[model samples]
Target: MSSNEEEKLLSYNGEVLIFQLSQGDLAKEGTAKTCRLRVRRMTFNRSTSTFIQKSTGIFSMHGEYSGFEMICCSCAADFRTGINLPCVVIRRNKKKSVFKYFLLLLHSSNEFEQRMNFTLDYEMKDDIKILNGPSILWRHNRTSFYISSQNDTIVSAPVEFSSIKWAGEVENLGTILFGVGEPHSTNRESSERSSKSDYAVWGTEFYAYSVESQKILSGSYFLPHAYGSVVTCIHICATKVVNTVLRISLIALTQKNQLIWFQDGIPKNLCQLPFQDPCALQVMASDGGDLLYIVSFRSSDVCAIWKKNFQVASKWQKVKSVLVDDFVGTGTEQLLLDFKDTFNTDCLTSFKITDLVDVNYSNDAFDPMENDLFEHNLQENYSLTVQALERRLQIGLTNIQELQKHLLLKERVLSKSCKALVGLVQGKAYIPPYEEKDILVSLCGEKKQLPHSLKEKSSDTYHDSEHVIEKMWYRVLEDHLVVGVEIKNSFLSFLNDVTLSLLMDQVCTSNPPIIQCKNSVIKLDKVSFPATLSSPCETESVAKRIKLTLHNKERKNSFHDQSSDANCIQVFTVVTALSPLLAFHNFCCIVMLHARWGENSGRFGETCTVPCGKLSLSIEDISSGKYSVTLPEKNKPLKEPMEDLCTLLAVFHKFCFQITSPDCTLTSVKIWLLRHMECETVKEFPDSFLCKSLGALNGTLFSWKQKSPFEGILTVY
Candidate 1:
């Protein structure tokens, strides 16, 4: 054969016919009676003329004959007696032309034919192509056969059957559907008299094998009637039944050994049928095998078809029903139905599969209960999410509050530390050093008592002659100065009065000095002595002998009360005033005191000179009163005695005086002597001999003469 002819034969799209030559036909044709399959290719020639003929003409074309060619022909022992019903199992591998073919053969004898006469076998290896793996077959007798790639047999033990009557394999489900026959009756008399028709019955129980569990599960349902008791045939598509819409039929034996029919492994009565008794039950499934079309024979000339629509709920709905003639044909895109009557009247119609099946169902078909359940679950999830967020928020707030409290405590500690640091820098705060002794004992002693006044003085007398300033102290604090003076007196004479004064000299040469005074003058003669001390004289004489008292003196009369006995009387005074230290960089403080004595009447009634003294105070020495200044020598004469005496008399009514030289060589001395005696020798004794003699004399005789002349040359004799 040419390559083109071989290719055309192999690629033929039309059906190839298989013929079995009988012994008589083979003898008559004088040929080998081999069963074989053949293909006949047809071809036509087209006219190539392009010219248009204006005149009408008859066109004729001849067809060439393409004789039948042998494609798949076999003469093996299995096909020697001719094959029975055969099924082709296409291999899943598209690249291979190998296939598994199963053949059911019946070897019948008169007696065994009424019983089990069928033998089923399959062939996987051929001269054309080889199968790579094993093929498995499980039979109704509980035996499993495995044919390996080497064609070796692997036989397993018998498995127990869940039902007594084995129907057949449900090819779509890859499981065997079985049935249980009804129980036998015990009445032998009724059974013996009954006709053969009375023995026919239907199976009561059914089951289908579960591939996953390797067990049989129930698939039984009730039946309607038993008029046609035995099942004549069964047709099931190799499509798995997922929804209730698809259908399958099988034949089984009853308990009495009678045959019966089962649809979908269940009794026909329990199934929801579209029509009562379907003369022709045609089940057309969708490409996806989810929908089923059950076409029933309605009348002799009319047919009705019901389409079962599958839903998401795993339930089916009879969505469409239509009537047409008993003619059905399927094309790629349309279904052709040719209706013909008994009288030969014919009509044709075509429908799209989508239209016949009612592909678009109403919205009401969705289960409302399921939607409500879904919403409920969604709400529950949302609530849980909200609650979780709230819990997290609460925890966050708690942590924040704790952090705030911690921050506040830290701030307080920082503030206290800052205050302590400030105190140390300013020097206003003091902390005592730690000591071994009790703190209370160390704090005791002479404390600095607050001074109510600026200055205070107190005096005490120990003996009748001695006088001493016991305590004299001052403090300069802030803007005020406080001076304290205490005096001790022990003189034997009466004290007429006492005067205390503070003299401040400005350090600047241009400013004048300031003097502040407080006087305690004796204005009364009543003197009060302490009861604890015994006077040197009797109590009655004490009052008469010493009449010391106190009185404030005006500033103008500050020098008028200098009559106290300086050695006997004591004065205590406090002076408080605003300090001059704030305004002056340096200043001098002099404490001046004056004491006067009364005359002693019993001893010639001589009155003593008034006593006065001054104390200079330094800023450092004021607190302790331990400084002293020496008095100038009394024998030293003043450079200008007359001027010095006049200034001294102006400040104090009674002040200490010291005369140095009485020699006549110092002319000022002669002049001072004349002035002391209130004798103006130059003027009163002018041109007199005494004045000249005194003025001219410069030796010791001159000093004596000067004094004698002042005495008025007293002792004449």
Candidate 2:
């Protein structure tokens, strides 16, 4: 019905006059036989102006007794013809006892009743209100309800309440919220919550209570998810039956286009269906009995639509999978219960073709004359057929090949990028090679710490001038080695010339010669050198003996004294230091000495020393320790602003680094100040640079603070 008509029905919120009459008595209107009618006046929407349609007969009363009859009434639209309202007649039964009357009537405070336990019988009047008990108002797709109550004051409140008696068993359930208005506005308040997309589910429970003391009466959990699963195919079976039973039947096409029944839930397995080429399916119910319809195309020459009785599903031996086209279109076809239907190669068995033929050409008028017409028809028929055949033969191979090629290209790009990154990290191109330079060579040796198997052999004993041997050893002194390197060009020049040249310049540029006194020897023609070295610096007051040791003493000694006094003459030389400039060299200058021959003169005649350079150094120990700078008191004179700021920055940097650094060691800050001195490159950092650095540090510090594991216990301020 239209909204106007529905609104008119709702406006009649007043007493409703319901009457029950019999059909037999109403047919004899002219006769003296009066039908008994039971009339009960209950409140209804007084504003309604539409004709009321009810399924059951109404009840009312005759002159003196209750009569059941059909009443005839004329409507404005059909005024000329007589239309009747089917009703029943009711009368008072006086013989029934008071106790029996009391047992039949039940009342509540919300209801308007003239009398319930009175001695006299009650009669219906125009303005007198009677309780309607309960009823349903509206229903919809998701939520539905049946309002139930013991009584309703229809005269004033006029609330249409639902009664349990009106609500039949689940099998006899009907629509309840059919005409209900939208509960309230469901406008979204904000975009964030709107994205959630909230939707209403079915609420099965409904009750009537005072606004002050609301209480839950009766409720049930409704399955809304199940309803949403197959919303498009919802069907309501309205035919009534004696016993209520909900029989549901579902017919659906599987992902593989196979016909299947959704027996328990959704069809999850395709093997359960018999048909391999299903076309369409539908579901229907009558008298609480459900049926499934399935259509299938079996090869190009056959098609059928089959009906399966859902009530007999368990008893079915072999459900027929029907192919529909054979019986639908005009063709030279044959019907069979078992593989009998067939069509020619013209595709007369396709349901789509049959439907097209039915819609375009209702009558059989075969034309075989025009060539253009035949070509057009042939093109229409063969286009889809050839395309389908080609697609099946290719089987999506082109798409699969394209995807593989895309993945291969991605892998190649990733591999190339990874290799480039590795090369960059290992100093492949950015770091220039170190240029070779002349370095002073001084070999200083000490006694070997190895077992007897690796000891050095004794030199040949000869009565030679001890003071003379020391003079020949001057070439192996540490100072002479430094002077030699200063003269020759080395790869270290490039290291000192690079961007970080200042760090390399920190090492002492030059050193004085190292004087070697007492007995010592030198060998310039040796092929191999020793591993251990011993040498005395200039600070040592007394001259000591130089020792020579070998890894394998069983072999011949590789050293030879240059002169008879080689052991006596003092030797002066220089050795390369462990500075970054000379860090790349693989050789170390060393000085050697021999065992003393007497208290003043050295023994064992002569000795030599050799030392090799180490490849790497670690600064882990240098970064940890307590470091502090004591400032003069406030009363005392102040230092330059740059000096103060530098000291503060250095201290702060060390502390912040400790907190943020992954490899920081915990130590007092004061020790750090003692080890490294701050050189004032400038008086102070410019305000811009200082502010930028401070901001960056502050942001980093804040991030670290937020993520700190000991956030609450430790404060950064």
Candidate 3:
């Protein structure tokens, strides 16, 4: 079956996407089942947008236009439905800066249409500078204004376009102040007397900036003592003051319970909390008279504060308070409490944090094998219990097998047999079986012991060499004695000129040896003959012959001794010259020759030239201390070299061999020699060797040679 079909057959049912609930928050479907959920269908619609139904049967909407539509509610409708709802619309015109435009809009949707707006003017400069007011803000070229409501909470996420609406709310939208924050005096007497009134010191301040830059695009009014309490949030008012510039109000509270208000750097108002302890505070802008809201946490209780003056407020009032049980566990619920600080918006309705989505594993699409999941799992000791059990079972099985092997060894020793034999050679005692002798032999060769009275020789007299030889001959039976079994270094050492020339004469006389060299040929004829022997000790005869040939030219010519010094290179040439000594030996009793390079290094070459005309050659680079080659056998039997010849010769640059033969005539037989030696090395003897060994013992000798002395062939005996 195909792989896909196999997978389909193997997969089980009931997969799920699980979500976790936090704190006391609970999630329930319309049907009340809660363990797992799957996305059957999803939509974006109005009735379901931001509308969450809790397990406690309470319904809340965070924003009228922002929420995901449920998959199966059947109430899923177009998101456009929110545009026509009874919501207030506040619009403001944007003032352009170097990086961005700042505008403010605010509205309430649940009750009658309530709206608020703010207009901010700022210059394009290195650092943003405000020119006038955020009080009379405008959007779509409309000046900011608002409709009031009692029950609705106004909020928005900064990412949504409606965050502009949240920025424009004013606590008292209809009110306008004169001279920034304090009302301007119409009577001359009042203007002069106003300097003494505490209310006359009031002022408004505006802060504007793009959220991403974390920069103040503009602040029409100053924030005093900005050290401890950062500007966590800002709310711009829509109504203009008597001076025609927008009335901007700022509400800033320190962590130490001190609060201040300013208009264009002029201090207008100040207040202090009833308690001296510090608190964590968050701010969110809202609609209608409640312009800005603050959430503060003191110990285990969270408190909310709202400021209502259109310009500057002399005091702040508490709007809500709630208590929490577990401090750390309620961090998420605290997020809802502190939403205004981070986003400059508030959760319009208080939420119980119904559910939290699962903490997704990061590598959902990664391949498990590629990621080494199996290896990681194996590293976990707690997860390997089953695998550990299987490993123990395997070890137990191996122990049983070892026990069986021990029992088998005992049985084999008990059943082994004992066998023996005896013999005599020329009246001397002998052992029937000798080293290298065939283990299986007939009892017919066994001899009985002789009577003791037949002889007695003195032990001192028996110590003589002749007696030793006699004893050896008689003590070893013919079946047990191996005669003339020599271990030549390796087969290649037998190829030398002294043997090759003798063998060539035995096989051929009419022509020169047919040597193949670079597809060229050279012939030798009528050459003055010098008898040469392969034994290094035979220079006695070679010197005499050279002297004889040059007797007539002695007075006028010079002489050079060619045999005075021979290097390892010359020795290798000398050895590789003999190939026929091993030609006619027994089919199985072959010789092996071993020789090293110039410095006696371990590197050496081996060639097995068998009795039946088959030659297998191997050259090795022995730094790694191992050699192997295959020699192919066809007409006879051989395996080819196990390694390439090139690597062999590269190390053991030079080497030698030797062989012996009898005399032959050059007048009758014709001989052909075919050599196969292909090796790639810096130093190469790029020529094949072909020669024959002739004559029963001695008679006439003919030499096979190449006429060109400078090519590759080096003839040495």
Candidate 4:
């Protein structure tokens, strides 16, 4: 028989038994006393065990049995006595019988049983249509059932399906599953029978429908599958309370019995399991369907369970495996396994599917060696950099030290040179002849007169000058003036005593003279003769030497006049006695004077001259020094008219000396001459003659010449 026919037969037998008992009880209670009742007897055949009920007709069974018993409902009469009851017929005597018959066949198995057992105290107002067979899986059949919670009524709707094997709902939409034939099916007969040729491909098909609208929401299409493969079984599981959109997991069993997972009908190989002859496949959800569990049973009692989280949707993880040794059944939330222990004793265990799965799984592992090597290389590089910097720093420090040392050495040499220069300026150290020549000749040439013959003299003369200067040279040492004088017999015999005078101009008086000798004054007069002078009997001339120092004191008063012309000239004088007797005649003294007057006193090119006197003297060359004489060459006897000559003779005389130091150069000479003398014509002298002749003389000459019958100042250059 077909599967649907078998289901109907089973349902009919169950309802008939319930009908007889329920009616008999009702008659015993007198609830159907007013209604006419009819009895029917039916016999059962144990060999065939078949029964059939026709609408308002007769009851029949095949293959009679000896112990057959039948009951009548109207009067509670029993027909158990030997009767050849192959069939029985009962007609409805009243409308109640028709209603009774209707209730007998129309009641579902569960309702029938309840009525017969008197368990239902309340009557049902409406009749419920029963499903006599498994739901019909056909196209365009109104076979699907839903329950309305508002009125608790069963709703039926016609749903479209083509070659669909399973149907379910995920979230709001119902999902339909079907098999699409392989590209080249080995079973050609099945392929040719397909009414829809386009869907005859070897893959899985999924379709979605809106349950509320009773309309298809998504198309019926084949899910892409592996080459040369087809899907055999598919189970879709979703969360219980749908939110936003439903989260569903599709577990598909292919023709090869290889289980795979599908997201949106796309295949994903997520789990690995040992292949076996699969007998059944089951899927369920837990934790409000956020987690899914799948179990597959093999012929050898082998079971494998897989778990997946709907939230992640990446892959499935193998949760558990068991060799049951007996059968086991997996429920929605739990698993029941039957097994034989070591003693062959049967044991049953239940487990929660969620507890079998691990939710967090990761494969994160690293090699320790790699980390160590990287750190070592980094440390080495850092050390190398530090070492390089240290080396460069050391080199820089060495260079700096060398530079500092060089600077210090240069400073030391400079300090020593400075000390030597200071000593030369203070006359504490004697400068070498060549170095002295460099200073006196080259440097002093800027403002002072240099001796012409000294420039022509040899190195021998430089030594001779050094020794000769010990007796007659004069120098400025620091703030003191040193004078060395040599007296010869000619000077001593000509005068009993000598006087030396030093005079400075108004500007030069800023440095007042401090006499170093007890007997010396600013103007020394009638100085005693030198002790080493020659005795009167001696015909040869002997020399006597004396040295004197003139210290300069700070000026007590100032002579700088601001109202005067800045170019006004100042002259300084120094006087020495050639003969005291001749000095009285104003013709026998040497006067050394220097004029200092200019915008800059150190500049000697500009000089001022004042007209004063005229005196004629004959200049002649002498071996001792250059000498000048005013007396005529003839040796005349002393006459009273020569008194004036004596006066002149006493004032001036022929003397010779040489200047050793250029510190005594005189650009202009000043003299105090007699103002009461008769006027005379003065002869002009050339600069060349004066610079040559007068410049060669060591001692200066200061004399009184008659210019007018009155006394006046005289200046000469």
Candidate 5:
């Protein structure tokens, strides 16, 4: 959406913003079945109900024309479609207007939300019309929306907007305003009752009114309008806006009753539009004064092409409604005509804005406060509360800005100090006395989270061309990597020209680092690029995979031949260091295994050196675990009730439990297979060849061939 080409709708006078509706591809012939294409989208938007005059954000949101997203959703069916609509965004667009593509957003009349702490970097000099953030321009990304000044357009009497005055809690910010009744009788008999200063009682949202249009007033409210404010410019909120703010899902009316709302018995003007719910009901303005912008909720992109398709010379005739449904008992054509009339610019002239310098809301309150002081009270000295609070606010704001500047300066100094420290440490530690700025850059910042874990980020991209074979068992004691080749092409059973290479994606060698591969080893004082790790070309063979499965019909064992899968796999592992433990350095390493497959290609297959994909492992995995790891496999099949008993105090401190099979196996380890450390200690392990979830022994086995002779389960809680 190119907002750079701006053409506002509300800003202009007579210019109508014609929305261009995109046509759906569900094309059908004349004999096709008719179905309604209605879509309802709901998003939970939580907002703090605070009314402080903090900055309200208003940023430009764009539609599909500018920032369309591809949706690959799955339900009963795999539906891969391109929905031409904008995503629900929190920030503004960088290059286009918010409404550039279309206004597909749920517009709320409670629009002034002071949430985001941001500034527009400009001075405001008005009663503040635009929300304090990036401007939400009413721009059409497709066909530029049309606009006309009030000069060339004819101005008619604006819709009458009789502003209401309230008392009590909700005097300032009127929470709920009902206008579903006719104006009170203006006769002399009812003059005192129908006067503007009369009290307007409020009711609960679920209140049941009597025939007299009155309900038992309940609840207390503190109106934000307590400070008093006159309507500056009365502009009717769009239907979508009002429904969204009020969260009105449904609005049904009977034949006898018209959709009229009342504020203190004052009738409100509204368009007679047929809709499924309140969301489609138009909140019409009764009157207006000068020409101003109209807040339109409908986006220009998906609106009907209703730009006076017929001749404008003939009384501006209303076209037959193209709606798919009827309105009440009458045709929808007339209702649609009334809907367009709601946006008529001719009603701008009646928008008269008047200020209430001094308002007496005594009679308007259900319980009006009595005036206790006389005129002399105004002459006495008093405490200025709001002024003092404002001063305190100024001090806090001043401190925040000053502290932020100071932090920025200190951050710069810290960066310089880190570099100097890295230089000094390298000179003292390096054996060859080399200089590598990038290597030592990580001296100050090393990943501490997920100490030694590394894994692939995304699914493997290489399909049948997988040539990298991992050697994990060789380093199984120190490494946790357990993955193999995923090959599909079974015919090519051998890999040739295999080259095992290593590349350090990260280096934190403030201390000299050592690199080891196979029988080769090298200690480096500094780091360089394109390092080698066992760069010897070798060959590996793949075999056909076979799986045993029971025949569904025969109930007998059957062999399922997986010809595409490779059974024999070549594995490899890489350690970050040659220390006592595994990789402990906060670093990233990319292992590139290049190999050639299939050489007899004269007529069968081609011998090509294909990339086996690059695997970049980094110690960047973080785990913000909230709780300790639960008992390994306990409760997997539901918790087992422990049955322990102590016979007597004579043999106290001795707990006993009868074990039938213990559901474990006692496997003996060969003496020659044990390491020097393992041989020195007792290698007596518990029943290890058994499911721990089932049961272990007096204590379950933890590690295989360990020095610790006893095994115990340490439950956290």
Candidate 6:
């Protein structure tokens, strides 16, 4: 037996897509039916109370000709897997007691084609909760949810992808957001002790399966004591994320018109709602994030509104909330509304709502998920190409004379280029960056800028060393540091009797800055080589100095101070005997300072230029109190683009990550790239950090790092 095959797929546009099916009386051949899918603009209406269904789209199959009988029609979608969409499931009965089903999705709203079809083996029973786009993970009365092998009717999941958790039953299933889950209830014994004991009862006794995550989140929001658990329903005005964790602000309404907010599954006094039930039938936030609009029914047929300012005095006050009825509704009608301020008023002044009772949805519209910018990555750019030789006849003198009549029609475009068109047809414009995957044929030189601090430090380290910087690749190769001399006169004299000494750490020579410096590798791995570069590395000892001390806050102990000072870089600068008496380290780049074996102070010729590594840094932390810069709230077990980023680093021996926090908080950092090593105690505010080479980093860099998918732990306290 096989059921639920993808016979059609639908693409969701901004409008809501509705599916309605009607099976007519059976004829000699078969029963007549219509699977109608339509598009409806589910928005708010102020003028009209009665709703009308417009002819947006119509996709239906009439007059069945086959022997299959329509069993039932339902909707199902597993957003965590391949596609996040509500696919229509159609069951059927074939000859000889055989069973089959079809899964249909809109082909594409943009494409004028039929819907897509997918079929899965095993028959599914109805009366199971599938409303709101969730499906039960069982067949033939809660039977086994697993299959041993892949057949023509079903595909097998990957071995590693198989989950070990049980696909247990969800008692009293209600809402279907990501997966099926047991309805909320106030049944904890602690609830008898205290009305709020339900808050402490965090359990995973509901749906253990999810398409959104490998391990379903282990938390649920049960109704508080005030809200009864008698299968009551409430309208969800809006929702908000509480933090980086999946915890959210569940703002919902009650039959008592109580506008409540549940933070992390508990009702909190987030804001003051007016005694008149807030008059917030619909709640929405402003684009600026400083104001909110609340719409509610003031009277039997009158609408009222209020504004809550968050940035200013932070008070709830009345706004333009007047609209008409609050029109009466049908059993199937849905009211959608939006807040708008056409005028440049500080607060919202207008609201529009409408009733979409008989609208439709189908895969016949453009795919919002495919064409989205952030959620679903937009499609890659593609262009048609052809050889210049193939188009030689089309570009000949004969074609120029034929285009004379249409020349005037082409002027409508503001700017047009014939060369671009020619390139498009000839395929010359789409030249790839690489000539061949394994070969390179082009050559070019670009002017590169070296850090000025290196030259300045060289002058301060050695009195006789020259301040001039030569074009050099300091640590281009494995374990080898190369220095090029401009071969100038004043520079040659400085190298003479210079005793070299390496300070190992601090970069500033004028005076020790208030901020301190520490060096440590961010992550340590014993690999043969890194992906970007391939060569035998001699500084494996440097890596050996640092153990795998991950910055895991979940660990019972505190920070690791033993390996706080990891030998990440072995850089030495040119110094002279005349320079200030400085403490040197065990291993450093051999800097040419004035030579003298016994003297504490290096003999300097009154001038030396010490080159330091170029380091760019950007950090953020609070200054007033002792706080820990923390790791981002983990998306447990890990999920994608997030999981993809981890895999990217896992595949390669080394990874360079640009960390970011949603709230934009950071503190101390330690990074050890190929040759240069940088570490320092930094804060987000009050005390700004400055690198020896790149200077003070901009706070905007925090906002800029938002693109990176990786994050690191930070701590200063």
Off by over 4 Å in 4: 1-165, 174-205, 209-211, 217-222, 225-229, 239-248, 277-279, 283-292, 298-302, 308-334, 339-717
- For model 6, residues 534-568, the per-residue Cα lDDT tens digits are 12253434433332223322221432222211311
Tens digit per residue, CA lDDT, model 4, 237-260 = 443334454445566655444566
Off by over 4 Å in 2: 1-135, 139-168, 171-717
From the highest TM-score down, the ranking of the candidates is 6, 4, 1, 3, 5, 2
TM-score winner: 6
TM-score of model 1 vs. true structure: 0.21
The positional error of residue 653 in candidate 5, measured at the CA in angstroms, is 31
Name the best candidate (by lDDT).
Answer: 1
Better of 5 and 6 by TM-score: 6
Cα-lDDT of candidate 2: 0.25
**Cα lDDT tens digits for candidate 3, 31-122:** 22121111111111122222122112111212112111111110111122322111111212222322222121111211221122222253
TM-score of each: 0.21, 0.16, 0.18, 0.23, 0.17, 0.25
Instruction: RMSD for all candidates, in order, please.
Output: 61.9, 36.8, 40.5, 60.9, 32.5, 27.7
Off by over 4 Å in 5: 1-389, 428-713
In terms of lDDT, model 4 sits at 0.29
Better of 2 and 6 by lDDT: 6
Model 6 scores worst on lDDT over the 10 consecutive residues at 617-626
The C-alpha lDDT values of all candidates are 0.30, 0.25, 0.25, 0.29, 0.23, 0.29
Candidate 5 structure quality by residue, lDDT tens digits, 628-675: 111234223212111000001111122333221122111122221122
> What is residue 649's positional error in candidate 6, in angstroms?
71
lDDT of 5 at 542: 12
The candidate 4 region of ten consecutive residues with least summed lDDT is 683-692
